[model samples]
Target: MILHVANPIYDSVFKYIMSDERISKTILSALLKKEVVKVEMRPHEYVNTTRDTLSMFRIDFAATVREKDAEGEGFKDRVILIELQKTWLDTETLRFRQYLGAQYSNKINIRKDSPKGFAYPMVAVYLLGHRVGDIEEPVVYVNHDVFDYNGEVVEEGKEDPFVESLTHNSIIVQIPRLKGRVNNRLEKVLSVFDQSRKDAEDKQVLNIDENKYEDDADMMYMLHRLTAAAADSEMRQDMNVEDEYYKAIEDRDTAIMNRDKELKHKDEQLQQKSEQLQQKSEQLQQKSEQLQQKSEQLQQKSEQLQQKSEQLQQKSEQLQQKSEQLQQKSEQLQQKSEQLQQKSEQLNNIVKSLYSKGMNILQIAEITGINKDEVAAILN
Candidate 1:
């Protein structure tokens, strides 16, 4: 049998169905896979804006879970804090952080029995209307596993408050990936959210085979609730309002993206211009440094030439002094030569005078100390 049911992916439909305590318990049990002894909803604020209408529905459930003892003789009841968050289109990473941080910081999450006031163990469940990264799984569970230095897995104590309070295990359901892959009971339960099951004529309603979930009480109850929601005049009106609201949001987002792209292009042009100017400045600086080096080399060469000129001037002065000394010596030699010539002439005249006086050659020679042959020659 085919039944037309309201699509719970719609914020209004989701809020309508999950607001019921029995429905919340059934969904939690299916997602957590734990036997929930009891569930009590903690207080949370809700806003009715189209944008905020259960866009993020966060509630705390003080849930008591029944677990079998290791000895298998008894069941132990543990109270845990389940921080349930359901989000539609927008699943910002920071938004998840903000919600978790708020929950962790809230003082109401503490246990009343402990003297040190230890916090209750927290488990976070995120129902996303969108996919996360490249993960193709419809359901992703993130749990903290302990390891030793030797890379061996260590078993965590079942009731360790310190480790459990600080860290949490998380379950993420990517509603879009739920498609036709219903391999388990959990998957079958989640198949209702498969957007592929949406009715062709109306997006607000989904077409599902009622026989597939006839044996499951929880599943049937959910289907009946959604069917009622689909028939409600107020619920259908709210869904329409949501449809118009999302359409406007989509248009707004498109406009913003186009503006961002334009701004990015301008930024790139400015950045290119900045880089070009920087390159030119660097080139000019390099040229200036080369010129300064050349100027320093010229100064050094000028100093060398000045030193060489001063050395040549000293050598020229020494050569001038030597030339003057040579001239003085030549003048002294001329005076000596003249004096020798005068002595020679006087001696010759004395010899001639002796010869004219008729003095014997031998007497002249003796007086003048001249050789006899030279005295005779002069007299003749």
Candidate 2:
């Protein structure tokens, strides 16, 4: 009989080992940090039409688990998803988010007593073959912790029914970091898929004996199956084929991640350029407004200067009309002076004629009624 070491990386073996009810319960309970008393397997292949297509997402295993609430009041149903994702990549974040969204959209039956529907809490557990994220911890657990703007945790957020109902818990187990004796429960549980193998020359040394973990029945059963698979010639060939297939996927994912990085860098540059152009446009508009204000001020000054010119022209016209009126009055005064001079000369001539015809000066004066002195002087 040929005895072989267990190789647990194959999907067939993992599924077969987890199909057992007792092992599945123990695994779920440990990962969930709760007591899982009941388990019911759900159909793994189903499309969630309320969200994106199911073609992009797949679940290795899923089940409805019943666990007692933290209050110790009663058992609650948790829709648990167990995923086998080998590598963690930057681009797979969106795909993961979409998968969770689809699961969240699954609603329970509508009750006649209440108008609203009920949704089950979701739990996600991922088995990673390689290191994916920046964190250094071997095992990672993610719980929805709420904080306020001041960075203080809110008690109400943890206790509120609405907030708690929407919260989903997740666990990430990294496998390549495993070596030596599996000490803890989580490490022992994860060891079922510990398929670290040696070359052909040291094939005998690569065997991980089931007796080493005799206390764990689940681990023992899983190791028995893996040893059985290693002994079979056809299953060994099939395992080689699956390994090649997973390698191809990893290669494709790497290429896609590189391309996505390039695209993201280009997008950042374009967004920066767009913001610069908007700023320039605003500055140009401000300059145009300043120029318009200056032009309006110049126009107002020109209008005021034009009004002053018209006022000066009107004063000049009034002055010219007054000079013409003074010239006409001066001519009239000169004519009147000449006419008075001529009348005085005619009176003197008449007096001389009267003196030449007079008998005596006295008689001439009496007759003419002139002064006696003026009459005598005219006669002499």
Candidate 3:
């Protein structure tokens, strides 16, 4: 038959459920697979009653375990410190460290063998209300094993005081992932924290099949405890308060996320603008360099033109001087021509007189040094 019980996801309900010594021992034994000889609640166990924000619901225990001897001859008793925490958010790394540091620093986390107490091995169990990264497993066990330089395991399951006290082991139970998975006794014990079993109509209550867990006495005891919690008026009221608190926290986180997204968008836009401005500055610098080159070329062309102009001026001056010399030569030639004309005229007159007096054409040609035909033609 399906039975109604208080949802153990609530801090108040979870505290109530784990408060039982039998349940705690049963759970520890199932998870660690060790025979728990004794269970003692540590002083640090508490439920944060503040409704301001969602916080870790943590509990600590010191368990005496009965285990086989190293020689496999007999049994031995060992005391180990266990820290169990339940959290709804994934952002608990710093908080987990701080809590763990406190446990390590605690003076009572020691076993009494010598005059001074020796440190006990530490075990951390986290009941995460949310999923961890991409791991889909319901239970994750993290243990430390010593290895030699040859890449071989030193001691497979043997516990050493020096190593155990200094280092620790951890078990993380993702409660959200415990859906339809009851293959082991540990998973079955952890089914109490499964959110899927919660009643569809009500968030505070869960419907479980009693017949399935009827064979297990410890499991039946746990269901009875949760059933009592469901009837308790005060526990029910506390569950409601927790619901409101978680709602407020979710709303606040959403707002912060939205604000961060807006800031990221603005930052991206500013980055793009900065890149564009840089490109424009480079283009302007290139244009300035090109203009400088063009100015230099123009200066060179102007210098060449000036040299050509000066050469042309020199040639013009030389031409002018040659023209003056040619004009003078022409004037000298004209004067000489005039002198020759006068002499010719005088010779012609003399020739006429000599011809008229006694000389003939031969004498006239000899005197003038002209041909006889030319002298006759000149006279005619």
Find the candidate with the highest lDDT and give its number: 3
Model 1, range 191-222, lDDT digits (tens) per residue? 88889999999999999999999998989999
Alpha-carbon shift of residue 163 in model 3 (angstroms): 2.0
TM-score of 3: 0.69
Candidate 2 local lDDT, residue 162: 51
TM-score of 2: 0.51
Each model's lDDT comes to: 0.78, 0.55, 0.79
- Arranged by TM-score, best first: 3, 1, 2
How many pairs of residues in model 1 come into backbone collision? 0
Candidate 2 lDDT over residue span 1-380, tens digit each: 22355354554444444666666676776676666666655554442221112112234445566767777799886554454333322235665675566666655311233344434445667666667567665578987787999999986647443554567677876666665437677767665555464436633224555566788776666566556666777766755665665566566557657756875676566556545554554555555455555556655879875555455445444544444444444444444444554554444456655643434667766876777897654433
Instruction: Work out the TM-score per prediction.
Output: 0.67, 0.51, 0.69
Model 1 misplaced regions, further than 4 Å = 46-54, 156-158, 264-380
- In candidate 2, stretches whose alpha carbon ends up further than 4 angstroms from where it belongs are 1-6, 46-91, 108-115, 147-161, 195-206, 229-238, 247-380
Local accuracy of candidate 3 as per-residue lDDT tens digits, 205-317: 99999998999998999999989999999999999988877777777668657866875686566556556655655565555556555556666789876665555555555
Can you list the residue pairs that collide in candidate 3? none
lDDT of 1 at 41: 83
